[model samples]
Target: MQPNAESVVVLDFETTGLSPDQGDRAIEIGAVRLQNGVITERFQQLMDPGRRISPFIEEYTGITNAMLADAAPVSQVMAEFADFIGDDNLVAHNASFDKRFLDAEFARISRSYPGEFACSLLVSRRLYQDCPNHKLGTLVRWKNITGEGSFHRALYDAEMTAYLWLAMLADIREQSQLELVPFELVTELSKTAKKSVGAFFSRW
Candidate 1:
């Protein structure tokens, strides 16, 4: 697929804990839909996981159990989010974590959700290896990207990743010269690959 600024959905989730397989669930989900490098829309929601919120997680995200008592369940939120993402590629920092949670939620709802995904962490490591750190906070400081909310919140983190992805794209274009490379080759190279357009590029 063409890796243009458009046709991407930057997503993030705040969860009750680390392992969804252990019954951990998403407490919040957020995404920013972009078209041609501009955000066309956004989605953010607090989800009631029908479970208790551990004090550690609550403190970290400032989302107490009380706050989510009236929130919608993951099944409903995930369906809405799936529609928001449509057929576009999904973007996230350490995307597998988010994808796992999303996939598990879909599985619970008896719905299928297998979609293309891009990891900003992987992208950052490939494109900005010279930088000392690729952590979201470090990148924000290094790139001078401003974020409005606290860390650990889904929407804020997704927005931060979106901005970081844009900056990383600029770096990639400058280094690789807009020649399209298959995401698989980039994966194999452990970095973004430089390829002749005629030799690479595939539609997802």
Candidate 2:
């Protein structure tokens, strides 16, 4: 059986750099657990990557090296994060980026998650084609979703992404005239051709 959008955890990561392969590490992770479409729990942590973050990264994410200097180590943070994740499915905007870091960090602790991941960015691209773009902030403005008036921070981005994910699920249900929108259908929508999206819905 497929999970509902209401029951997944929405997560975001702020990292030292783009790829883990390049020795980049996640300095922070923020996530919210949704139950029946309401946020029931939250998790946020900043970890010491054991290296000074670049000036550009510091400016871009507003996460200073000093802020991370006293934080817990990566292994401790990831182990706690793993407990927070438990068995829920995951959602993230631009999930590929977050997923890479998540997998890399989990590997450090020899941990793994069984839940599937869904990309709000990909699903939004297919669902909101008329929108100028599908970036998390842009979608918040387009959909009139309330935001905390900040971006690039881990928890705030996860919060916005969570709202955006819910909006897309609502759009799908309203447009398809279906009462329930399965997580499987949302993932499928991400892969459906743009021109054939309407036809794809009919098949459901």
Candidate 3:
């Protein structure tokens, strides 16, 4: 996805477990629609995976099986989420994990989104090396992204991640003295060596 795109869907999924390959599935989906640097809309759903959530999963995400009991089925929820996503690019902390589940879930409903996925975690690792970790919670605390959402919850993490994405873009704009941060700049930044980021962007 073009990092500089005016609109993007920042998404996060709380799954029954890690690795969809091992039969795990998403229990909750949360996302914020960010357009022109503002969150204009939001989408969230608790899904039923046709199974009980593990104790650890329940505790970690605070999404109880009881809460999901009356929720929509996984396939039904996935279909609606696909519609909510429309064609917007996606952003996530560690996007690979989310992307994997997205692909898996969408396939169940014969839906797929072609937008590119960008990893804020990767971008942060390149931009901010002083931080001890690049986790969403770590970035939230390090950058002081103001809010009252707890970690592990999909909506809160997605909201916080959206703020963090904007913060980084703002930093880039002020530092480069550019009208708006270029999407290519962030794409390149994600692939650039940490030590070379400053020099690489300098030439832009």
Candidate 4:
């Protein structure tokens, strides 16, 4: 049988700003590895981005400049993260943002992952179109997923995204009546158009 929610990494990043091209950098990263629909391992680290973060970012993520003062350098952290990844497929709430930073940071360390990324946000949008919005927090509430802690912090957000991913997988399996939902199916569903979503599932 193909791997379902049994093996993958859900990741989140706290960044200094939006775009790396605009000199932004990831200040922290959090990821959790799932096996058999449960998290079996975790990776979290705060990196020193070698510059002062904007007051807004500091306020937003609650990762102060003071906290980053003595943290490991981005290159060092990225190298360790590359090892932690180790060919695992990745998931993120809004994956493009995290993927961009992952790529940028990997480039700095001359490292890359062969695994693909699946965005929980995209899959949720298709599965839960009636949701008020697709933001991580919104979906957590909309699905009644157990949300015990805070958001914005890399580890906390990654944890929440992990649970949300599991919830979506369960829903898809129950609704689609499939014994297993492959990573490829989730990736394909993310690309399926809204209007064609029902047809997409029907054909599956």
Candidate 5:
């Protein structure tokens, strides 16, 4: 996949807790579909996890227990989200967390997606080592990415992640003199040593 030339979905999830394997479920899901570097579609949903959210999680995400009282169940929302993601590559800030919830929720619905997942967090650690930190809010401010919503909420975080993804692609294109940034290059950069990163791109 040429990340700069094709459709990609940037996604974020606000969960009832941290670990999906430990019974934490997604309380909210927010995603944006980007095509050719422009956001073309958006998805956001609040789901009831059939369990009560703790005070810590509620305060952290600003999503109250009452807010989820009438929300849809995980199975229904996951089905729709799976459809929204149809065959497009997926990006998330910390993808392992999101991927766990996605896999668990999809398994409950007997659904699956074929797209590869990328972590903007891992990529940012490689691309912007000078930044004080690689947190979503920090990178958003450091990169001057516009954000329309509050932090810890799914939608706004997803928007910021989309902008970060674009900035990294722009950086690579500028540094490598490439017309388009390939998906493989971004993933490779995430794993490549910082000292040899520039040379690795030149070899590409």
Candidate 6:
């Protein structure tokens, strides 16, 4: 499916750790707004997760607890971010992971976030299956896309994801016959697959 102009918000989050439901929280959120394949604007913030930064997470993201001591709370950042997203489709590498953190943050503030989401990881698997490694770093290098900052930072990774998403779209167009499906349909199929897998496990 071809993405419409200004229809996508490519986003990423830097969190204290994985599993937002387990008390982890987003320490930073970043996103790039895209209109017709061009990035029109960006949003980024360091969030006060209201917890101590773990040494492992700090070493990974280079964001210390002290750095976020005065940062805005997740509620405020998410509010501003929700405004930026504005009902547009969202994109991320490993999107469900990021969405879990975002939804958890929103839940904490008693707000709801509902929108269409896309995963660049799935797109990469669909379009570049020959590549042995589908990690963001590996895919970025394989696609010859240059990332400005280190990995794990929200904005930098989001920027790279945006580029990678565009490139994957191009690759899919070049290689596939499924050219006319709507973006919404692609997203729905992905979500359905995830739910089917989850339901299977729950029943097991």
Instruction: Identify the superior model by lDDT, candidate 1 or candidate 2.
Output: 2
Question: For model 3, how does the per-residue alpha-carbon lDDT over 142-171 read when each residue is reduced to its tens digit?
Answer: 998899878888898899999999998887
Model 6, 72-116: lDDT tens per residue?
988899888878888788889999899898788777778765667
Q: What is candidate 1's lDDT per residue for 1-204, written digit by digit as tens? A: 545554478999999989898989999998998777788888999999998999999899999999899999888998888777777778888888998998898788877645577788876676666679888888888889996898788889989999987886666555556643344444433443534322332322
Q: Look at candidate 5 and tell me the lDDT of residue 187.
A: 72
Measured against the true structure, the TM-scores of the candidates, in listed sequence, are 0.86, 0.97, 0.95, 0.97, 0.96, 0.85
Model 1 spans with C-alpha error above 4 angstroms: 1-5, 179-204
Q: lDDT for model 5, please.
A: 0.88
Q: What ranges in model 5 sit over 4 Å off?
A: 1-6
Query: Which pairs in model 6 have colliding backbones?
Result: 5-36, 6-35
lDDT of 5 by residue, 118-142 (tens): 8899888888989999899999889
Write down the worst ten-residue block by lDDT for model 4: 1-10
After superposition of all CA atoms, the RMSD between model 6 and the true structure is 6.0
Which regions of candidate 2 fall more than 4 Å away from where they truly are? none
Q: Model 3, poorest ten-residue lDDT window?
A: 1-10
Which 10-residue window in model 1 sums to the lowest lDDT? 195-204
Q: Comparing 1 and 5 by TM-score, which wins? A: 5
C-alpha local distance difference test of each model: 0.78, 0.91, 0.88, 0.91, 0.88, 0.79
The per-prediction tally of clashing pairs is 2, 0, 1, 0, 0, 2
Rank by TM-score, descending? 2, 4, 5, 3, 1, 6
lDDT of residue 92 for candidate 6: 91
What TM-score, to 2 decimals, does candidate 5 have? 0.96
RMSD of 5: 1.3
Model 6 is weakest, by summed lDDT over 10 consecutive residues, at 195-204
Model 4's lDDT to the true fold? 0.91
